[model samples]
Target: MSEKIIFAGTPDFAAEHLKALIEAKYNIIAVYTQPDRPSGRGHKLTPSPVKSLALEHNIPVFTPVNFKEEADKAQFESLQADLAVVVAYGLILPERILNAPRLGCINVHGSLLPQWRGAAPIQRALLSGQDKTGVTIMQIVKELDAGDMLYKKEIEITTQDTSGTLFERLASCGAQALVEAMPKILAQELVPQKQDSALVTYAQKLSKDESPLNFNHSAKQLSLQVRGLNPWPVATTTFDEVVYKVFLAQELSAEQVALLGKIDDLENGAIVQVSSEGITVKCAEGCLLLQTIQAPGKGRVSAGDFARSKKDLFVRGKCFA
Candidate 1:
């Protein structure tokens, strides 16, 4: 527990782990996070959540663009840290930097090892409709999240989970898992298990291009898309040439299955019904209920509220492009 530690991360997820280590009273010698970037309406440079948290603790913070520079690499080595803990650090570390620490580095990844190993694991897991996913504490190999596993804590992927919600849960899960693994790692009691290459699956970064909702897909698939993209590049639909962001969505209930059968021949994406509850849009195989939506330059509102404000647009037989 006296080992000098270097904490590296960027987002709120990483901040959570940093907070855990601090609360556990670990010797966090320094912190590493991405450089401040322009954010929000004014585009002012904003510190990452990790940086802010570290600063609050009066911890020395490093924001090197990368270890590509000799000075940056040397600065890291000068610390002579026993271990480096990385989580959602954004920057890909070089092998030299990874080896700078005496005990090398370990990553708290947001996925079960050998699968969903990339930048957007939580979102990809939901998008793929996985029944369960988990966090993995692994060695920091040169390859992208292709490290040997140290420990894993699996959790169920509930039907109600969105990437945003999963982010919060996984951050907490990963934080506890990391803190639990640290002592064993320092004591050399933990064994590393090699990953199964055959079972590997990557979760590529989410894209704005992937945000558009396509009614051509089944309602179930569309529902996944909506959940996966929530809180970032939200699932969108074109209505009257305006882009409307979709938040909450659902497939028809067992009783409502009869309703879809009635309009089994109607054009997909056409409005089936608009009630006080939501706007039902027919899909390729079934109907999807749009529960919440957001218009350009406006706050998110329930689908029923949007319908009331734009009654003409939600009229039956009208199509959403």
Candidate 2:
């Protein structure tokens, strides 16, 4: 028999998992997602992806402003759910709600836990230059992502993987892992191991003010930062007192490094030269080749186009703030 599950989630990533569960024929009794909030440039209020998916499946959805309220808690417990699945739910589940389900709550986290255990796992992993990271299905406890692992799947960190890309892959992988873990979870055959508190690392939520690219960091570190923050709050820097976003970049190749010799020792964001490939800029420890960039009030363009558009900005000794 399928377990009577209560699903809770908010973003598209979470919705993917919910869809997988529903497609697998799980008896989803209800869904709980955060209340709608203003979004997009127009700031229109829209239902969360999870809510939309639940509505399509003919499952009831609850958008509680306060989970602690008597009505909200009563409504949740009334489902008498056998289990609860949560992914990026945005709202905290109190002890009563956590223990209400017969099999307790399970969460799909985007990082290898005991590390990056908070609001921005995907971004943190990429920013830290982690060569490998992946999803972890765990038994949810009261603490933040401090749960026992039920399943995990690792993925390689390619030189080009951004937080946005990594998130999509992890979300899909998590859905598969969650579906497979459900059977063991229902049969009571899964073992829950305790996480080591001493080794914990937190992934604090990112903010718009954090997008400025610091050239004082090493080439690899700066590159990772740019990639992690891309597509939202993208890394920005000032050139000729005008802010420009670094859309794509990488460490300079040996050929380009030879061409940029000696001049590469200049201060941060100093454009050494523009070769056939791209423009070389000095970083704290090495050099970065700007592949794509966007000038203030302009759309993104290749380094060659940007250099051509603003010749003075790409001069040999000019530094970007």
Candidate 3:
């Protein structure tokens, strides 16, 4: 309990672990988060979720741009921490900083290691339509996420789980996993297993080019896109040059597919129906119901509301193209 812990992280997911450590009475001596950057309509600087929580606890906080400078590494070394706990910390710690702590560094990674070893694991899992994914506690090496696995906890990935919702679950799961693994790690009771290079899969950072939904894919695949991209570079489709963010969607069932055929001229991306339920669009293999959406420059609204407000734009046979 008296161990000097240094926490490094930047997002809400990381904050959850920091919170658990605080609640569990871990001696967190300092928190290192990314520097505040411009955000929102006003473009005003804002503290990260992890930084905000650390400050509230009166823990010493540091926001260095990077550990490229020797002085920055020295400042970290000055902490004399027994362990460094990292979770979604945007900056990569140099080997010098990683070794500063007496116990070296460990991370609460979002996905099962030897897999999803990069910036966007949660999103990648959903986007790939994986049935399940989990958290990995691993030693932090210089190689990006290529570390010895300390512990792991798996969770099911449901059809309804969006990246945002999955993020919430993973945050809680990662926090619990980290708290449970910490003591074992310090006691040296936990054995570290080297990651299998053969099974490694990289979770590359998402890009804006991946934002637009491609109806040429199957409804199920498109549905995954809708869920995977929610809350960042969100899945979108343009009609009349107006981008509509698809927040919620579902694939058509067999019965629902039977209900089609009323519109023979329909093509992929064609508006199938605009009912109070949602806006149904035809995909290459099936139909997808857009349940929630955000119109251009507007707040999120039910797909029905969007359709009702623009009846002609959503009429049957009108293509998303």
Better of 1 and 3 by TM-score: 1
State, as a TM-score between 0 and 1, how close model 3 is to the true structure.
Answer: 0.95
Residue 175, model 2: lDDT of 93
Backbone clash count for every predicted candidate, in the order shown = 0, 0, 0
Score each candidate by Cα lDDT. 0.92, 0.86, 0.91
Error of 2 at 139 (Å): 1.4
- Ten residues in a row with the worst lDDT in model 1? 257-266
Q: 106-222 in candidate 1: lDDT tens per residue? A: 999999979898889999999999989889999998988888899999899988999999999999999999888889999879989999999999999999999998999999999
Specify the highest-TM-score model's number: 1
Off by over 4 Å in 1: 259-261
**Residues 1-321 of candidate 2: C-alpha lDDT, one tens digit per residue:** 567999999999999999999989999989999898898999999999999999998999899987879999999888999999999998889999999999899999999888899989989989888899888899888988988988888888889888889888888888998988888998889888888889799999988788887778877887887899987889888888888888788876567567656864477878888765567788877788878888778788888766866676588878878
Over 4 Å off, model 3: 262-265
Q: CA shift at 226, candidate 1, in angstroms?
A: 0.5
lDDT of 3 by residue, 139-232 (tens): 9999999999999999999998999999999999999998898899888899899999999999999998988888888999999998999888
